[model samples]
Target: MNFLNVDIPVKNVPELDKGFVPLGLFFKNYQKGAAKPLCIAVERSGGQIGTYETKIYGTPEMEQADAYYVDRLVKFLLWSWGGFKVSICGDDNVAAAIRAAYSEGGSRAFDKGFMEQVYETEFIVESLPYDKKPEAVQRAESIGRHLDGGRIGFDAGGSDRKVSAVLDGEPIYSEEVVWFPKTISNPDYHFEGIMAALSTAAAKILEKGGHVDAIGVSSAGVYIDNKCMVASLFLKVGKDEFDKKVKNIYTRAAEQLSSQLGYHIPVVVANDGDVSALAGAMGLGENGIMGIAMGTSEAVGYVDTEGNICGWLNELAFAPVDGQPDAMEDEWSGDIGCGVKYFSQDGVIKLAPRAGIELTGASPAEKLKEVQALMAADDARAKAVYESIGVYLGHTLGLYAMFYDIRHVQMMGRVMSGKGGDIIMETASRVMDEEYPDVAFRPEAPDEKTRRVGQSAAAASLPELK
Candidate 1:
């Protein structure tokens, strides 16, 4: 796997400094031959060059003429400046394209070093694929299956904070939950349990002839770069040892599983919410979108451009409100994060106590069921509570819209759907219209197809597999 660094050289100091243009990336990989890059970075300036950014959705192979036209345009721009210059970091194809674009019949003119190329030992930025969307997805899926046993994910809860190995969008393997027993005294208990749990999942995957791709942990916290846990919210694991310990446990489990399965594969350790987002973002269904999971705490998520789960997508808990600047932190903190304090199950409980509801008589889940019953009965009090909760939910969702730069927000967990879903959705739409008339917010129900596809894509990203 080689990388290409195509530098679009320009003279303007200001434009270059600002990284004005959003360069498009395209590349091709071969099975039996060397991989080559079909690269181009077209920069437009406000002064001499007109400022314009257009997109070509198809690939270089599918849209050969379009790619060629782009190549020619880049060459012309380069020559118009002084000479066409490109830094080739992959195969000879990068150099060849420049030569062809600047040749005698080519559009650009060059005196001497028009096609001169050099091999520099520096980090280069190669573009990601922009063509053959279906094919690219298929390739990614294949890679996922190859790397892991169709699983790559994370999970977290009260005493169950662990990464997972998912396949076909299901948790086939998981890291052990760290139980924080009130009467317990041993420090190693949590770590030992987690290791054992991870090993158990690994053993199960290997038994099925499925490989291990990546490990994703979902807990009550924030994770970044799939490497470190920012705030483990309610988890007992410290921020310091999360990276090292999780990796070590996953590595040992993968090795053990591979030995048992007669093969070796790579593993990734990540946060659970991100994995849930990956499951949702890969189009799990009609609502195949923004994943908001609330258990001990709440987390909002979406898949990023890198095909990885991202918990930092919205962080609506930290969002600032207009009339109440500190409402986000003051109102939406502690047990609920953003969802509960305003919209989730705990929010319902909070409302319950205020409305003389008997929430103490039943289990939390059962109590939630009762809330849904109240909503179904069309009780005026329950209706009002649900509607208000819906508004709060929508407000958070609106934040998701602005942050992700996307519109559709999928509502997950027990609190957002079923008997209360319609009320919540209606309120979300209404509030979105009131707060942000310019944006469109459509809520969707979950489905199997999107989940399967997302899982497939995530699974395809597993590395170090045969």
Candidate 2:
């Protein structure tokens, strides 16, 4: 459950081309009525531990007695390599019994051999399961049977909590749990909420005797390999801890869920847009295809040639775009992001003033509709706005192609709704064709079923796992 903090020295040896040091030895008896002793050695500072099993015979026979002598030899060698000072060897009851019998008996059977007390220290070790699976699943399923199928729900924009259980391909159970909230001081507030939702969902699945295949999370941030948190619209929970927490929860969730379901399986954690990409890519018959969801934000993910996940990736806002002098795409590009900045809701807001079109609410979809009607009358500003959105999307996709060798790009979300999507797709296609003459760029829309499946699949692929 917890790791020990130990200080150990590092040394280099020149003569024998090796380093030598002393180490502490601890022994434990795991099996009942055992004649031989199962032992383990731990460095004094506890940085490492080595385990070995040995059997000592009653008769001091050269061949058989020395046959099991490898144990002591191995421990000594390992301790020496670690640069520890071995003063005396300290062991538990079983180790003591074996040592005493060997010492007092002395001949072949009586002489179990020599075990010098290399170090004397009061340290202890205990036995624990490597992990618990299958059983946890059974327990979770038992709980599920008694429930009314309510699942825990989370508000993407707020903290409204509810429970809901939907059984599509797999049983997804969501629940509410306590979590530390993020504030202005912690800009990743929504990201924290996403993690909390995942944790509660994991717990619920475990409680209901169900196996969790993967968890897809929708957040206002970015995802990288090893589950690294690149940036967030809300919080600043450094990438180090973000990766650590996500991995830890993933392992715990998989083990517990598997145990409840009575099966051992791996679980994946992924960003929502990445999941969206995966689901969208399923329909595309290409080796490497990516899906980009351009909305209030942008999320990108790809499916490899074999259908394994690449990753749910983002943080392209900071990516540089061509033909933009002295400008970072996120800040200086005509839009906030080349593609998302121009095509998303934010893009809509910025373009309204230039086109002399005013939207009553902050909805990009509503604003776009208003802009479309104005443009239908051949308004130059309105048409330019939509055209620019398409051109930016095309340019961004062209850049992505260079990095991933991607073939088809599936577009989704409000950005892909109606006429704007068509224009964007046309622009993106033109850019891809111009840049990579040999490659093909196809665009398509994603349906609901594929979206759900893709989301879960992408989530299941989250990485930096133990």
- The number of the candidate with the highest TM-score is 1
Candidate 2 deviant stretches above 4 angstroms:
1-168, 171-228, 236-267, 283-286, 309-314, 326-340, 358-381, 430-437, 447-449, 452-466
Candidate 1 overall lDDT versus native? 0.43
Residues 389-420, candidate 2: write the lDDT tens digits: 65556545544553455656778756566666
* 320 Cα displacement, candidate 1 (Å): 3.4
Per-model TM values vs. the true structure? 0.53, 0.48
Among all windows of 10 consecutive residues in model 1, the one with the lowest summed lDDT is: 132-141
lDDT of 1 by residue, 307-385 (tens): 5332222444332221121223333221112233554566676566555556644666677778778878877666666
Residue 207 C-alpha lDDT in model 1: 74
